[model samples]
Target: MIIRKAIKEDVPSIVSMIADDKLGALRENYQNPLPLRYYEAFKRINEDPNQELVVITNAKEDVIGTLQLSFIQYLTYQGGIRAQIEAVRVHKTYRSKGIGQKLFEWAINRAMERKAHGVQLTTDKKRPEALNFYEKLGFKASHEGMKLHL
Candidate 1:
């Protein structure tokens, strides 16, 4: 398997993997021809210097997993940059093969390479297994994250 920056063609596979989960099923709209908004968002992400959208592909170059990493500039922590990881998903058939770990490792390394002060991510409370997996990766429950949907 190879990890690389996602291309336009990989969007469908990425969305499919994302929507395969119970939580994601409610929020993601995956169809034969995906909605225009997804592509528009992809375009914005691709054009942004601080955004890195990546995909893991199999030997045949089929996208099987995906994640988005963002470098956020903050005045706190002495103006340090923080890496925020989001949208991490592996194709249902590809789970338990360490693909997710590999994706996190790559993202964390990239964040370090960019001189980020820390890496952060939020997982839904409903996913106990995901929380455990993240804890195993050395991430602590250091902060309580709250969100508001606009």
Candidate 2:
């Protein structure tokens, strides 16, 4: 498996993979032509010094997994940086083969390289496996992060 930074060429596959996940209902809103908003976000994240998108591919160059990482500057912790992991998913066929773990480890190490004070991620409470995975990766629960869905 090869892990590399994402490029525009990877967008179609990435979008398709996310759309295939039942948990991706939230993303379906941006499907079809995959609006400018999505493009802008991909560009912003890929171009920003503190953000990144990684694609895991087979030796054949077919993408099998992907993740988005954001390195944010936080003033609450004396301006220390925090890396946020988002949209992490592995193809169903690739699950249970240590691909997700490897991708996560790579993200965490990259965050450290950027001088981030910590790395964090959020998963649905219903996803017990995701919760367990994060715990195994040494992440402790911080607090309840409430969201206002309007």
Clashing residue pair totals per candidate (backbone < 3 A)? 0, 0
Q: If candidate 2 were superposed on the true structure by all CA atoms, what would the RMSD be?
A: 1.9
Q: List, residue by residue over 89-109, the lDDT tens digit for candidate 2.
A: 887888888999999999999
- Once fitted onto the true fold, the runs of candidate 1 whose alpha carbons sit more than 4 angstroms away are none
lDDT of 2 at 38: 70
lDDT of candidate 1 over 1-150, digit per residue (tens) = 999999888888988988898988999999989998889999999999999999998999889889999999999999999999999998888899999999999999999999999999999999999899899999999999999999
**How high a TM-score does candidate 2 get?**
0.89
**lDDT winner:** 1
Q: Kindly report which residue stretches of model 2 are placed more than 4 angstroms away from their true locations once superposed.
A: 29-36
Model 2, position 14, has a per-residue lDDT of 82
lDDT agreement with native, every candidate: 0.94, 0.85
Supply candidate 1's per-residue lDDT for 2: 96
Clashing residue pairs found in predicted model 1 = none
